[model samples]
Target chain A: MPVLEVDHLSKDFGKGRVVDDISFHVEAGEIVGLLGPNGAGKSTTIHMLLGFIDPTAGTIRIFGKSLRRNREDIFARLNMASPYAGFPNRLTVFENLMIYARLYGVAERAAKIRNLLGRLGIEELETKQMLELSFGEIARVRLAKAFLNDPQLLLLDEALGGLDPYAATLAKDVLTQLQREHGTAILYTSHNMVDVEEMCSRVIFLRRGRIIAMGGPTEVTRAILREDRKKPALSEAFIHASRGEPHAVE
Target chain B: MRLNRIAAVIERHVYDAKHNLERVTDTLYWPVMDIIVWGFLTLFLARHGNLRPGLISFLLGAAILWGMFRAFQRDLAVSFLAEVWSHNVIGLLATPLTLREYLSGLLAINLLKAIVGTAAAALVALLFYSYDFFPYLIALLPFIFVLMIFGLAVGILVTGLIVRYTTKIQSFTWSITGLIMPFSCVFYPVSALPGWMQPLALALPTTQAFEGLRQVVAGGGFSWERLWAGLALDGVYLLAAVASFDALFRSARVRGLLVRIE
Candidate 1:
């Protein structure tokens, strides 16, 4: 069964629609990429999934429960992480994660925080205040917090944007391991086409507030490159998606 | 509404207070300073005229209670502001924590801070000025309760506005209490205001609370009518504030205002 199902969801700000009737689902252990250029409504979709904003139309169900009606229950089973958000500047990394651990109702909080930090290769940061860390280190802390609950469904919005190449690779590894071990479904959005192609089992491409393409990375590339004999990279498909040219619908 | 979630938020705030010097000074240092400055002024006045007995008790008690009002109001506002400033509000909202659980934690922390700050100030007064507020506490409990409730209500209202209107809401944190101080007659009687302002002042629960505080300070027992009136106003104001917060929160979510907290 799908861990998350967002059906015909739409969002408008005043006269401007941001996410227009986009729908998708993430089954357990599947990592679905939400790919879009700037203002293509990827973040808006994530915001709606997190229940940070209300959708103008349609519904979002997680674990077969309505997000509007069972937000707390659904939220407890899921988590979101973004590089744009940080821990309290005055708090140590451990202190910050401890609060989330309790809020997420994770048992064995110490073990979880320690293990997560170790897995993220930032265990030394446990005693450091947020203000004392670099943006990349803080990104790792966010990952620790996001996965501390052992979330069944995870939403990641540019969550790996600030990490270095090595850290990003490690972070991606940790994500897939969690998915493989615990069947944690993930919905991810990032501008890094290479990362998305590598990590996502399937991709959803959005342009001007709607999904323009949805399929496996290779299939999506092939779909966008229809009628052309040359197979192309995901980045090439990204360029085509951004150019707003007509492409074969998948 | 859940205890564990609420405790989690409070735990964050406690860690915040424990680590941040500014927050530490807010709960301890500033209250101590208020008592020290005001304690000296009362002595200066006592040397001038035949002051009412327990006059030090009166002024210091007012200061202590008023400090608590500020504590309740400012702590809630500032605590929420801390999250906004650190860009951590989204991190919190993304958790399993409900709105009721979040606000309950902040208010619970406010209550704890008010009690601790009030006690600290009172302790200084007892040690230095030899003025004990405990004797008057039972008599003044109802009035103090009203004032604290009003303070928390204002905090909630200001927080909602901040959530709705993003920038410049920080001004409300510092200036709101100052704006309400005169109308509250914090240092004076309601009759001290002009006749037109008297009715306006009396409409404030803080004004009534202070009046009752003064009555008890002068050895006059509190009037049931005034206490009930203050509580009624507090109830209405509290309900309105809660409703406004709920509406503003929903509107903010609809408009994606929460994501703009930073």
Candidate 2:
């Protein structure tokens, strides 16, 4: 069974549809990329998957259970990280992690926190308050928080956007290692095609709340090239697709 | 509701208070100043023979009680506001923390603030006015509980509004108690209001609580009837507040406002 399944999901804001009939699934140990232009419903879809927003239609199943029916049960095994939200600024890095660890019911939380800090190479930042940390350091701490629960399925929405290159590389490496060692499934969203090509095993392209293409990196690139022969880079292909162009050769 | 999860949320606020000197001073300053000012004013009135005997006690008592009400209301509302100000609401809500656990955590923080504020006001009252509030402490229990319940109810409703509307209505969280003060009759008798407004004043838990306080301070026994009336009204208001909050939370989810609020 897939670790995450979203079937025919749609979200309408009354004035217009934000997410339209989107469907996908993520198997254990798989890394799926959700790429879209701004207002393509990327964040809205992530919010629905996290149960922060209710879908106007369709259903989400995490760990083979209906998300609406078993939200707490499913959320206990799922975690998300984003640059848009963060820990309290007044608390030290360690304090923030400890609080979330307790909330997630992680046993031997101290050791787990130490392990995550070591893995993220943020041990030196343990005593530093969130307000005292730089943007890149704060991003790393948030990533550490996402890993605190040893989540079975992870949702990362622009989690690496604000990090320095070195920190971004470390984050990708830790995520890759987590998937390899724990069979954790990840649904990642980003505009950086380099990271997507480097990490994602499969990519799903969204345009105006609908999946326009889905395949391996090379396969989607080939499809895009077959349709719009002038566009070479995957980034250009993304722009063409986002403009509602008829070049999606899926 | 999981106690551990609730405690974790409370611990977040405790850490904030411990690390931020401004937060500590903010919590302690107003209550102390209010008590000192009222304490001195009551003394001046007594010294000049311009006030009735025991007028100082009535004024100081009313000030302390009103401070307690304001503190409870502010703490509860500010706890919710803290999550929004720090942009932590989405992060915390995404966790396994249930709504009940989250509200319980806020209530715990409110309790902590109330204790501190009440103690500060009481100590200042004794030091400056030599008014012993402890003699009436037992009688004040029901009044305090009823007032806290009313405060929490208002806090919950205001939080729901702010969450639903985001920053557009955020100011309501800080000013809602003040908006209700006229109807509450906190510093006066319900009968003091115009006849047309008496019914509205009588409908508030604060009115009954103050009336009960005045009764005890005037050598009358504790008014169980008034206490029960206030408790009953608080129960109704609490139910309405919870229902409003639940509906607004659902609306926030449907509107995708929770994740977008900050």
Candidate 3:
């Protein structure tokens, strides 16, 4: 069974439809990239999935339970990291994670926090308060917190946006391993097409609240790469894709 | 509700308070300041020797109890504000933590702060004015308990507004209580209110609790009627507040109101 199943999801803000009818799912161990330019309703969709906002229409089922009926239980089995969310500023890294660990009822919280910080290559940052850390460091801390819960489904909503190249690569590798070893399904978003191309097995593209393309990375990339097979870079195709010239695929 | 999750949330905010100077001032500094200023007022009034018998006790006792009530309500609203201010609402409500568990955690922390704030205020009253605040508290425990519950009810209603409108309504936190204090009769009998407002004062649970406090201190014995009325009012107000808060919270999710002001 898929870890997440979203069907006919739509959201309307005032007279405008932000997330028009959409359907997608993520299977265990699958990494699906959700791509679009700003105002494509990507964040709204993530917010709906996170239960931060409610969908005006459609159903979302996670781990075989209806999201509307079983929100709290579903939240336990999934986690997300967004550059938008933050811990209390005065709290140390370890302190923030420790609270989340306890909230999730993770045993041996101190040890788990230490291990996750090490995995993200920031074990030395455990004692630093949020205000004392740079933006990149705070991003790393968010990733560590997301991974702390051993979530069955992980959502990344531009979670690595603030990271430098080296840190992003390291975090990406750690995320890949988490999926490979734990079979944790990930629905990811990023403006960095290179990272999405390298990490996502499949990609779902959204333009103005509709999925313009959905398939294996190469298949969708090729659909838009009609004239230039030489430039296999997903970024080049993304430029055409976001410009309102979309190519649909299976 | 899950105990562990609630415990964790309490731990989170307690840690937040330790590192936050503003929180320290809210929980301790302001409550103690109220007592110091009010205690001096009572002292100055007593020097004229025209004050009614047991009037100093009424004044000082009310100051300590009023401080506790205000501290409890302020802490509750401020804790919600803390989550809103830090943009940590996603980190919290998005977790396995049920809304009841989350609220329970908030209640626990404020309760702890009220207890600690009460103790500090009482200690200060003892050291500065030689006023034994604890004995009066022990004697008036039931009335005081009812008064604090009313405060919780008001706090819950205000916190619901914050959830619906975000911090735009935060002015209600400090201002609403100040507006209600006159009706509560914390410094005077319910009869002291203007004749037109006396009906309003009688309707408030705090007024009854305060009046009951005065009746007991005046050797008039316990007011079982006041205790029962206060409890009944608290139950209704609390239920209404909780239901309204639940509705507002659901509305916020639907309206995408929790989207910012992190």
Candidate 2, chain B, TM-score (2 decimals): 0.96
Model 3's CAPRI class?
medium
Q: Write the per-residue lDDT of candidate 2 for residues A91-149, one digit (tens) a residue.
A: 89999999999999999988999888888888998998899999889889989999988
Give the runs in model 1 whose Cα sits over 4 Å from its true position: A228-232, B50-56
lDDT of 3 by residue, B76-137 (tens): 88888888887888888778888788778988888888888878888988999888767666
List RMSD in Å for every model shown. Answer: 1.8, 2.2, 1.7
Top model number, TM-score: 3
**How high is the CA lDDT of each candidate model?**
0.88, 0.86, 0.85
Q: What tens-digit string does per-residue lDDT give for candidate 1 at A61-170? A: 89999887887888888988986577789899999999999998888999989999999999999999899999889889999898988889999999999899989988
lDDT of 1 by residue, B122-240 (tens): 99999998888898889999998999889989999989888888757778987898888889987788878989899889899998898888888888877788799899999999999
Enumerate residue pairs that collide in model 1: none
Cα deviation at A123, candidate 2, in Å, is: 1.8
DockQ of each: 0.78, 0.80, 0.79
Alpha-carbon DockQ of candidate 2: 0.80
- Higher-TM-score candidate of 1 and 3: 3
Quote the lDDT for B107 in model 3. Answer: 80
